[model samples]
Target: MSRKPIIGKCRLCGEIKKLTFEHVPPETTFNNYSVRILSGEEVIKQVADPNNPPWDFSDTKGTIQQRGRGGYYLCGDCNSKTGQWYVPEYSKFVHIVHSALQEVKGKEFGALGIKMKGIKPLSIFKQIMTLFCDINEGMMGDNSLKDYLLNKTSTNFKRERYHLYMHIHSGSVERMNGIMVQFASGVGLITLSEISTYPVGFALYIDKPEAYNPEGVEITIFSQFNYDDEIELEIIIPKLESNIFFSGDYRTKEEIENAIQESKDN
Candidate 1:
């Protein structure tokens, strides 16, 4: 059977037109895998061995099968423009993350100082941030993001005091964690996140300037509008949050609520 093209409202422009699959993290990281798409939930996970935190997940076997087969939400124009404007920077960042992971195999993350050049921080930030919005709009059926993506642009991340924190992450059990997009609300702000579970794992935290920082974790606060030429980055292996969990063990809604509370208490 042949499938028909989807005619829909553009996620960015709101124009009624043909929509296309906007790979949440772009296709470079997902390798076009057919996977489960989850919105408003965590994909179940375990640490494998809590005692062995650095379990050399770099070589773990498995394919990330939960990237949600990409999301069909953007019109062709918005999709193409985003690709041209942001995907290249995204690919570069993904490559840097992969290299950083290989360098710290069997070792602790962070402590390794990384510096990148000729980069547009906002371009990359917008790319990741869009995935969160795309999921909210397409998967969760929300409209708040549509208006933001089109007009209400804010270039003053530092002035507005909003920051994006990032880290290198790999799935502890099998490293097949695909690009996972999640939304966490409460604690005085909203958190929109995207994580990749490949050996070169990544966590990008977008939160309000006043949101509570998780206890004991030191994050590098970065701004979108500031770094157009160079970006100073460090790769820390982030612990899985209640929102972004490993994929395997299922969590009941109640259990998930408990975990979120635990995170807040910390």
Candidate 2:
């Protein structure tokens, strides 16, 4: 009988004894309808395949089949400990934000309208901001030490922070507006490009495509709101380096203008 070859060390930790397979994006989040659509099932299935999976997908030949499908290896230890940031805690945080938004909407329109008008509106906005901020801090915080031969030091701590910031300021905000429109009526449409341009126009550039070195990708945000109470948000992250595309929706044109003013004030 022929013996199977072992794949090398863990990406995060350089342990030589037993390497655990890790998912670039956690598999638990992959099952969602949005994720499945965004990351096609064929791509997922190919990643999950035992024999001819992607380099980021598997460890050993037979070991891949042993793990069934959906997940890769990390020995026993790294598998258990890796990627805590993008797992249950992040999901829980998103749920909290959604719940808070619901509570805001449940109040009488008159009270809610008043809340949105005055300085006290800062209090409500603060609550929303706090939840996201805490989530970002918790997930991207420093990792605990492991005393293994290759796993002694920390891994990708800075990159993880960048990812967290991108997810919050860019991804989460866009997602929140979409969820608001899905659950509530009378939300004017805003595109992702509109929102992204707001910061760019104000010269508050938090992220850029060139900074990340993604070949030729260009990202921009936009938003749109109609007088008839419809909201639409679109984000264009094109592979063409020359094209700038980003978009999202705001509650209203006044809101968008106010946000720009707020950005200036800050």
Candidate 3:
């Protein structure tokens, strides 16, 4: 059966055009495999029932996406522009991180400062923002991203209003969260969106508070680099786990199981 046409507003350009499947991390960067897409209720049930077979679709509310983990969120024009201008460099960045991780697997370390060269930071950052826009539903207030994304060489993202962070992520779960707000005890009110998959995770905090210090290496500096500029830097990315549904919850599976056991014992 043919998939029905999905017509809606373009997340980036805000144009009402025929939308196309926009890959959040690009299919070339390890997002090509089939995965189960679950709702919040489904996720809670799956977590509670550890023996539930994730591969079994008969008794579940989740849908298995065979093409890849993405949706028809962007119009063809915006998708083409972002793919041509930004995705190449961003894909290279992801592969580089994955290579580094493979080279140092099973080592005891909190973080790794991977030295990367010839990286187009602006393009990578723009690609990251495009993913953020795709996962979100509505256009940003004031349409700031419109100007920043539509222009291929534009680097005028609203730095004061948005901050981006990144970490090395590994776990069974792949998260593509829309914009959500939550209050952390010491972190104040955090209004953020995140995309956590293998190799890397990103969080964009909107109108972040001054006192809010979030986990992960701040990569807002990527916005400052020129689109074509290539530079070398060592990024210290701490490995984090996405075993839970929460945006910033990086607890490992062992930690989670121990906590659950303790709760049952108590």
Top candidate by TM-score: 3
Q: How far in Å is the alpha carbon of 34 misplaced in model 3? A: 1.1
RMSD of each: 8.3, 18.3, 2.8
lDDT per residue for candidate 3 within 1-266, as digits (tens), equals: 99788898998888888899977779988999987788878766766775643322346668889988999999999999889999999999999999998889988777878999999999999999889888887654648788888897888878999999999987766788988889988767888999998889998899999998888999999999888899998888988777777787788877877777787799
lDDT per residue for candidate 2 within 1-266, as digits (tens), equals 86454465443344554554443223342223222111334345654554441322222222222221222334445555434322443234334433434565535331111111112211222222222222122211223212211231223122222211121122112121111111113433311111111011111112233333322112111101111222221322121111111222223334544655686699
Worst 10 residues of 1 by lDDT: 38-47
Native-referenced Cα lDDT, model 3: 0.84
| lDDT of candidate 1 over 196-229, digit per residue (tens) | 4443333333444365453212333333354354
What stretches of model 2 exceed 4 Å from their correct place? Answer: 1-6, 17-24, 27-73, 83-86, 97-164, 167-266
TM-score of each candidate? 0.59, 0.27, 0.90
Worst 10 residues of 2 by lDDT: 195-204
Model 1 RMSD in Å is 8.3
Error of 1 at 94 (Å): 1.3
Ranking by TM-score: 3, 1, 2
Better of 2 and 3 by lDDT: 3
TM-score: which is higher, 1 or 2? 1
What is the alpha-carbon RMSD of candidate 3 to the true structure? 2.8
| Model 2: lDDT to the true structure | 0.27
Question: Which residue pairs clash within candidate 3?
Answer: none
